[model samples]
Target chain A: MSLDFGLIIEQMPDILSGLWVTLWIWVVASILGAALGFLVAAARRYGPAPLDWLLKLYVEILRGNPFLIQLFLLYFGGPFIGLRLEPIPAGLIGLTIYASAYFSEIFRAGFQAVPRGHVEAAQCVGLSRSQILRRILLPEMTMLVLPQCVNMAIILIKETAILSIITVPEMTMVIGAIGSQQYAFVDAMFLLAIFYWVLVEICDWLGRRAEAKLSKFRFAVT
Target chain B: MSFKLFELMLWAAGYTVVLSAISIVIGLTIGLCVCAAKLARSRALSIPATVFISFFRGVPLLVQLLLIYNLLPAIGISVPSVVAAVIGLSLCTAAYQAENLRGGFNSVPKGLLEAADMVGLSPWQQLKRIRAPIALRLTLPALVNEAILILKASSLISVVGVIELTRMAQNLSASTYRPLLFYSVAGGLYLVICWTVAGGGALAERLTRTSRA
Candidate 1:
């Protein structure tokens, strides 16, 4: 069978729809993941012994296991637990949990990078712990953490493709469906790869811009 | 439900180890070659090598695996799903490893290469005797990190029906309807593997420091 350029082109709208779904999931999950990551990092840093251990365990479980399994559990096993989430919500939950673990590590590193003197200075000024963390620690760590957070965001975007397995109709699943139907698997996959590549390029561009803005703050400190 | 789930978890853990080993070896070998090519003098060779590294490193492993597993059959080159999984994973591993190796190579002082040249060492001899040892030392931490990443990424292979640890957990969950128990076990095995690798790397670093002293 010969390649059908026309057929592949005709399917572009369908594939683009899936691409939008993938992007939407990534954006929502990344926001949630970043919020959760900050909380996990804070708990690990200053919480009680049990809370610290619990946070550590949560991070390790999410980090060590594959996102695919986590997605499987969330999507397929949710019904058994009486949750009964749809594919998109399940995908969002899985990606957010998985990404949070990694983002927490980045946040931890970033927090650690903030000079101890800065925190001490805040303490000497009679600032409360929460005030010090909010004003002094966060602004200082933001520069260190922003690049890594952006990189993790890109990774989260790429990982959203795995949701296709749970029948989320993400870009990969759409390509697979179109390929099987048209028997133009190679062409379809090639096009799908280009789509992902373009998405990644855009993310990289944004990451670079963020890095540039953050690095000015970093350099001013050094 | 409990006993059966325990048996499945044990079996899956074993398979996870085996597949991780295979992918690591394959990834390292291909990674070395790709690294060498990227550093080669010829633009003709290194240009494509650069593109290959960027492409694989940029794309997600799941998409790569799906494309390979599904598209190969369409081209009348029908390998088993496992074979495709290995190929896809190894290629991704090679890409990341190549970048790490390049960093390793960059860390070698230029004076060391000049010294090797003055000693009349053949290029291959210099590479084996002088470069490889130093590069390996410099790259060890990064390599260990990559190994950890590979171990985690191997779970993506389950999408194409490899029945590795993650797949086993999924199956067990289906049978017993105990997602938490089976998934926790699988996650524990992964923690063990990752912790072992990190611990081993730390030990090696300590040992090397002592030896240097």
Candidate 2:
């Protein structure tokens, strides 16, 4: 059977509302993940040798697997460890940890991107270590990592779809519910695809804008 | 976890690798065709190729998997779970691989094509003798990166009822009341597979490093 465009139009508002759930999860998860990642990167960069190696192992374990499996571990598996979480929180935690893994690596690369000579020069100016990190390293690393972070954000947004599998009632879940209920699988799936396409396109546009703005600032500084 | 549970996870992990391996090879073939289409001077071919790349790369693979699994039957073409999963992963990876190969092909030096022309090489000869080797070399690292990404993403196939590694872990964990052990073991198995893929990539990179021409 052919698609009923009128039904799709009627369901636009219900479907579009999933957009907020998606954005909320993405923004909250990214902020939380990036914060945790910053700490981990700092530790990896400046902590004791053994701590750094341990941190590296943590990053590798998370990075080497799929976020869906990570979500399962935190959601289905968490209660075994005396943790019982609902879907949203379980998904939020899982997404955060997953994002943090990649973010830690991105941040480490950002840290490395800062030339050693610059940090040494800051130290030579009699600035304290914390002062050097705050005034010199953080700013530089933010610029270096902004584009990569946005890219990760895009990936994470796409990943938020997986949260629906854990019954998060997010976009994909809502779409599936509506589609199956009305026997409009084709229309529903196409609509879902389009919605995600628009979202990803916006993300990519924002990424380009941030890159442009950051590069302009870097040029001015130099 | 018990040995039986561990064995089950390993069995499912085998499914994961086999499925991903099938998708990567199939996707690579599709990607090469799409790359060739987009590279051609004809807008007729390139426009649809560009749209395919944008659509596949733009949508999330989970959604794609669900659509393939569900929509095919809606249209009276009911495929198996494995077929649907493979289609989803293959098309999704094909888009990314096409772009990577396009980049590799674009980076092939113009001077080499000109040199081939000067040597009286035909178009096919130029492609075989100069362009293919250089582009493949340039894109080898990207191919490896895509392979790892696919291996990890193959986990999503579970939603479509393919009892792959992660799904196997879930089933075993639910029955055994040992999420921690099964998941950790599953994670370790995934890491080993990924590490091997990455190690192979590194080895491939090293082997190709000395070949400049």
Candidate 3:
């Protein structure tokens, strides 16, 4: 089949709107996930025993199951809990929760990689626990966390496509609608793939650049 | 509503297990082949194999599932939805498994191959007797992890209307309007399956460690 530049151009604006929804989903999910991930990481690190156990269980439950199932639970199950969320909100919540679990593990890895000697040195200088955490631990952890975080972000972005199943107006949903409407299944899907590819490539590029920047610090440390 | 939800959960759980098992078997076989081809010396074979691995690895599984389930029929091969889902999952899982197996292969010492050759072993015998056993042992942990990942990913098959665990949860929620209870149960089942797989991986790792010592 010949490539259809004309059809692509014609569909560009509509696809852009769908892309906007996808971007919104990614941005919201990333922020919430990062926040929740940090909290879980901190809890697992410094919280009391019961809280640590709870956080551990939360992380395992979220990581062990598929995001699609979590999406179903939230989109369909929220109503039974007396909180009826819209499709977009439900999808975002589910993705955020799922992403948090993965990111928390990444965060924990980063935190553990921070040498205990460094924290001990900070203590020698009379830095309080909170001060050491804020000043030394977090700055060092960011370098370790950023690369994996960016990779997870790409995964989360692609995952948003699954939300289309719950009637969220993301890019995949748009592709599905267009395919059904115009009987342009192959064309619409090809376009959709391009959209996702571009997003993933951009995220990967950013991740590599960040990793490069972080590695320079490693050289200085050694 | 309660009884119906219980029935749906049981039914869906059964299908999920069956699908996961089939995909794992197919995926492991194809993955080993692709991994071997990738590690082969022939540029002609390795280059295409590498490209195939990257193509599947790069795209999301959901998109691949859609492409296989919805788009393939238009190209004249009308696979059933279940078949398409299985193929899509197996293909995706194989790409990951191939990468994992390549790591195991790389861990095999070059001296072993030379030793096998000095003993007048054929290439096939060297691979079967010297390479496969050690590689499989080293890679067992990673293979188990991938199995769990594939099992969880199989839930995506429900998108094409396979009556798997996730789909059953969706159907039950709609029918009973008791979404919380049904979904929680479905989610619980998934957790159990994954935890069991993970526990098995840990056991295998421990056994391997003891054996090596």
Candidate 4:
């Protein structure tokens, strides 16, 4: 059989609704993940030695395994720990945890790459620890890390598709349900591709814009 | 949890490893061709390569898998779940790998190639003796990193009905009604496999470095 544009148009409502859920999850999870990752990186950098080791383990275990398994553990295994959650919450938390692990690594690298001399110079000038962090470290690291954070965000966007497996009603799941019922799996897949491709492109464009803005800070600081 | 259950998990882990292994090999071969096409001067060759990379890289792998699984039948070419899964993983990884390979090739020193030309080395000789080796070395760490990513991503194949490690965990957990134990065990197994592969990659890199030196 030939391709059918008509089927896609007919299912536009379902696709749009699905895409809304995708964007919601993507935005919420990304913001939470980035915030949490920043904290974890900062803690690892300036926290006590034992705390640093524990945080490193946290980063490793999360990063080492597949995210699908993590989601499974969080969602399916939640009841055992008396932490039952709806699919949306579970998806959000899972994605947050997964994204944070990656984001923290990026943050840590950026934080470390700010030369030691820069920090020492700030200290020599009698800058308070908080002052140095806010005035000197964060700006430099943000410029260095923004591009990677954007890359991770794109990866996380792709990952939001997996939440569909847990019945999250995201684009993948919605399209998948339509495919099964209507036997228009090919058309459904086509729409899914378009939705996801556009999402990634939007994310990429925003990233480039942010990078352009931040480069001025980078130049000023250097 | 039980010995029998753990054995089943290991058995399924075999599928995960084997599938990732097959896909990486096929992806590398395909990636090489795509990288060549992308770096080629002709618009006819480069344009399609660029589109292939853009579509594959831009779209999610989950969608690609679903598309392959469903679209094949519509085109009168039905494939089994495993084949569809392999095609999806290979193509998706190929796009990323091609980009990586292209970056590696692009970084090869122009002066070195010119020096080879001065010695009267043919283009093929130049590629074999100089460009290929240098590009391969520069690309090695990225290639290893990609391999690990693909291994972790192999979990998504379960969506297409391949009973790899993640699928087996879901199955065993559902049957035993012990999601916590089974999922944790599965996660641990994945950590072990990933660490081992990462170690092997590190070893390989060291070997190549020392041999070259």
Candidate with best DockQ: 4
Docking model 1 quality class: medium
Off by over 4 Å in 2: A8-13, A117-136, A217-222, B110-123, B211-213
Interface RMSD of 4: 1.0
**Model 4 off-target regions past 4 Å?**
A124-126, A216-222, B210-213
lDDT by residue (tens digit), candidate 1, B88-140: 98899888899899998888888888999998999899899988888888888
Query: Lowest-scoring 10 consecutive residues by lDDT in candidate 2 chain B?
Result: B204-213
lDDT ranking of the models: 4, 2, 3, 1
Q: Over the stretch A1-222, how does candidate 3's per-residue lDDT look in tens digits?
A: 333445655777777888899999899999899999989998898899999899999999998888887887777776767879999888888889999999899999998988888999999999998999899998899987888898889878878888888999988887768776776766667767767777777788888987997787762343
The order of the candidates by DockQ, greatest first, is 4, 2, 1, 3
Decide which is better by TM-score, 2 or 4: 4
Clashes of each: 0, 0, 0, 0
How much is the lDDT of residue A61 in candidate 3? 92
- Model 1: per-residue lDDT, tens digit, A18-136? 87898889999999999999889988888888998888888887876678767776776667778899888888888888988999999999888898888898999899989997898
* Tens digit per residue, CA lDDT, model 3, B18-46: 89889988998999889989999999889
The true-versus-predicted C-alpha distance at residue B42 of model 2, in Å, is: 1.6
Query: Which pairs of residues collide in candidate 4?
Result: none
The CA lDDT at A49 in model 2 is 94
Q: Kindly give the stretch of ten consecutive residues in candidate 1 chain A with the minimal lDDT sum.
A: A213-222
Q: Each candidate's interface RMSD, rounded to one decimal?
A: 2.0, 1.1, 1.6, 1.0
Instruction: Give the chain B TM-score for each candidate.
Output: 0.92, 0.97, 0.92, 0.96
